[model samples]
Target: MSNSLELPSYLEKSAAVSERFKKLHRRPVKLKVEDLSKKFETPKGELVALNQINLEIHRREFITVIGPSGCGKTTLIRILAGLDFPTSGKVKLEGKKMEGPGAERGMVFQDYTLFPWLSVKKNVMFGLEIKGLGSQKAEAEAMEWLEIVGLAKFAEAYPGQLSGGMKQRVAIARSLANRPEILFLDEPFGALDAQTRASMQAYLLKIWQNVDVTVLFVTHDLDEAVYLSDRILVLRANPGEIDELIEVPVPRPRDPGQFLTPEFLATKKRLEELIRPPELAQNEEIPMIRLTEVGDEVE
Candidate 1:
């Protein structure tokens, strides 16, 4: 395989389509997250996971939700994907209240979520087949998405036969096959090795730049958050809340070379500080903090 996979022609943006997308990318938020909060009633008392989280995501925007544990990163993505409901506040998708899981949105979790019994193509076709899209059309859509992810050759393989990175690519293809308005990713590359993780990060950015969907990504990796997001939504733990929203001023069509550029490095350093703990931020003697201890969600 090539160091960089080739993108199919169908994935390319035509002159007219590109022009139209530029217009649609403007204001008139696609998702309105207003006063969002989630609390779970535990035996001890009300355990607040999120509080007063507000954000507006525009069409074709790549926004990443990140913070320490207990910061409600998972909860926020779940609410936006319609897998969970906010206790107080509302999430509007294109001006409509998001009630529950719908075809308009899709989610790719840390776990591949592939059926052990199904092949790659079958797994991607599951949703469309249920939606009443005939087998032929569903297969066609699945093939296109598989190609988009550089997994066209593995469409006949089962999950067990593929590597961790390949499995994640299949999961991504499955989600994109549905043509969702927004794709919610919860640490999709968290399980891979360092090398594979870096490769997948680049793959994800390639797909995102070509596709027209809005993205709400959740991650604990500071570098991943900066590399893939148009804006980073920083959350605070102890009842998760929005602390700040920082933009990635790097020019688009990003490549691995940009990772070393001054602008990219500056953005990454800024994000690290934004999420730094009060106790650690003041300690100049401490060299670094363990990832496991950082931002642990309130138990």
Candidate 2:
């Protein structure tokens, strides 16, 4: 036998993935966070929501941030979006310091924030028009985005007239029509049903592939994070800090079928290990009260 030892299949695959992402790494950094920190004043005392967070998002990269509740994932994204501020450190976008909310960044939230009174086309054109584009130009651009999102037919419809998924498509179109350098989505599909959520994920990937925008998605679903992210930012709770920035080994041009593949499973397993609470990681079981009697079997 040869003297060389065999590496595990996942490890072997990781080598190929590293090669694939080399181009991605070479791309210019679109957003940079250095020693970013945030604190909140609780009744008890100062609670550090995020501590010394550092990150870099490459141009046109899709990054997902996931963690258990209280991990400050939302806080971190909010700061980057300029919707909130950090107590310390700095956020730079395209080599310029971010002071407050600007057109360079676009944000989508779990809630459908469409203006109910505005038609779908107008909703998309809202930003363009605000930026002083002529009515004809803004409407034309809005229709183009609606077409890209497969919602052109519904351009005349109102938010209340559309399905949950359709509304989100409009929201996405509105954000993208502005052509922001980076898009921040905080659980944009959390309210959708499982089927719709999966559909939205596919749509998002297709959009990301074609668009020239960078994405930073915040989600609580492991499957979602694994399926959508080029890299997953795993955070730990209690003075929320970075646990790991996982480069997903799953190959690109991804499909739903890849979820069961070794690479996907391996990455997901590692994420679980990192995000699992210490008690659970230690296999410590919680005591439960016996509400049902010994013979309470219903089946």
Writing each residue's lDDT as its tens digit, candidate 1 over 118-224 gives 99999999988988999999999999999999989989999999999999999888888888888899989999999999999999988988887888899999888
| lDDT at 138, model 1 | 97
lDDT tens readout by residue for model 2, 1-299: 15533323433356667887898999999999999999999899999999999999999899999999999999998999999999999999988999889877999888989999999999999999999999999999999999999999999999999999999999999999999999999999999999999999999999998998999999999999989999999999888999988888888888999998877877777777687765525467676567677766453
What TM-score, computed on C-alpha atoms, does each candidate reach?
A: 0.84, 0.91
* TM-score (C-alpha, index-matched) for candidate 1: 0.84
The TM-score leader among the candidates is: 2
lDDT on C-alpha atoms for all candidate structures: 0.84, 0.91
* Model 1 ranges off by over 4 Å: 1-25, 278-299
What TM-score would you give candidate 2 relative to the actual structure?
0.91
Q: Residue 164 in model 1: shift from native, Å?
A: 1.1
Q: After TM-score superposition, what is the CA distance of residue 60 in candidate 1 from its true location, in Å?
A: 0.4
**Stretches > 4 Å off in candidate 2:** 1-16, 278-299
